[model samples]
Target: MRILMATAAVTALTLAACSPAANDQKSGEPAPPNPTQTVAAPAEKPVYRFKIGALDAIALFDGQNPVPNDNKVFGVGLTPQAVAAPLTAAGQPADPIMLEIHPLLVRNGDRTMLFDAGLGAGKGQLMQSLQTAGVDPANITDVMISHGHPDHVGGLVADGAPAFPNAAIRMSEAEWASIRANPEMADLVRVITPKVQAFRPDEEVAPGVEAQDTAGHTPGHVAYLITDGQNQLLYTGDLMHHWVLSVEHPDWTVGYDDDATAGKKARLDEITALRASGAHIYAYHFPFPGLGKIQTREGRATFISEAQPAA
Candidate 1:
């Protein structure tokens, strides 16, 4: 599903998209009145990095692009304004919403697994981000996908070829079937199917990694759980997108959900389970390097931004 907002309009209008003021403050950091003074020796922009026991996880920002905020993209009933209103109120661009597509790479022992390829070959910088993190695409042993959306699966093939030539591409059977059947995604499916390895729900295809069938967002939507003895972390692939929005109102369906009702149910259940388990979550669409925990407050679940602490 797609929601439209005009985030890039200011840039198109040439009204100072990124000024000294914008760049100096840094994201998740306080904005200085005149940040240009700090520009001389700027701090490195934060990169998402963490660990779950012995498993090391890194959030590689493949960069993001804006999609038109049309009514139908978000599914059937939701309007663009309805979704944009909250994000705008929260200080995010209201007209054209930017979707930050992050592809995660998890390293366990010698196994380097990349979760969701991101907007690969066509027009993203996932490779650069990976390199910045000291990871090579060829070093990725496994490429696990949560779904078949263009952004999620697009990175599988580059320039009409498999990006990770040495990696085994894995995804849900339902996702492969849906992508294959859709005329729009048929070409991508055809190209990636040769390398595509399908798996079912509740199955542990990888060592301590278990595939949990979340569904609803798309027919075969799934989440992966990584556990090391007692501690665990969950990679919720687009299961929950907007922070605060999804947590505050877990039932509010996004236009992207193929089955809104099913999405709502799965989200509620997953949030509950995640909270109870106290498992850290890596959300593909939560925010850049979307890493955080779900907290229960006021009888409702809330997404507390934990990647960077408040000053």
Candidate 2:
């Protein structure tokens, strides 16, 4: 449990939205060729849907990754046993913890916007999630990137081409620079460079979507604040990952943070801001369709998922 192990761990986070997603699979294994296995994915159930004034907001389910309760990713400065105690108390599995990756789709007038594309089309479930939501990639006029992490950017391109051909890839200038400078992400940069539209951290890339600089997790890490009339929802992108470990003990940093101290502070600040705003939040790495509100129970903030029945 090293307190600051950002350098090596940050490298692993580069190609992942969450480390578990990238670490879980063997690259060479192909999908089984059975006919039924290849059966076309249908327009499945809506992940989670609600409204933001005139805007139609939907949480698209990309996928989930379960990782062991190791001190590497989460709880960067504590033993696994220390982390497991919280899980066991919460009645959650104490061994492997689950992390979900879900993209958000918002419809404002003729403009269709997506907040961070998930792990590409075939590689993850972003496409199926989109299909189920009745949205076509071409209809997405804006792809608002929270940061340049692999999982968020992966679905931006597919098969060596821009996944959302008609969409403008928007991100903070600092974030774009970080991605562009990475030699390992050369291919990805090449594909999206032309479509990339770098803006200031707090710029309003779209009408109701204002990018709030929640830096720390990444240089230009941001959370989207979508406001329409009185309705609002915050798209929290990796500001915190685990629903419990993160919200309960945000002081416990994640190794993936490029700046661990700042990341922890960002979590505290976000929790305070969210509580003050009283706006719904979409946590990218919480449970699927992570739409929820923060409820301060007993003294600490806890997530109350509106998408889940028992919350």
Quick one: best lDDT, which candidate? Answer: 2
Off by over 4 Å in 2: 1-46, 308-311
Total backbone collisions, model 1: 12
* Estimated TM-score for each candidate: 0.78, 0.83
- Which consecutive 10 residues in model 1 have the weakest lDDT in total? 34-43
Task: Please give, for residues 61-171, the per-residue lDDT of candidate 2 as tens digits.
Answer: 776667788888878778999999876655455567767678888999888999999888676788887887788888899999999887799899888999999999999
lDDT of 1 by residue, 60-160 (tens): 77755554556443323667777676555444554455556778888877789998988876576788778778887888889999998878887888778
Clashing pairs for model 2 are 120-155
Residue 171, model 1: lDDT of 82
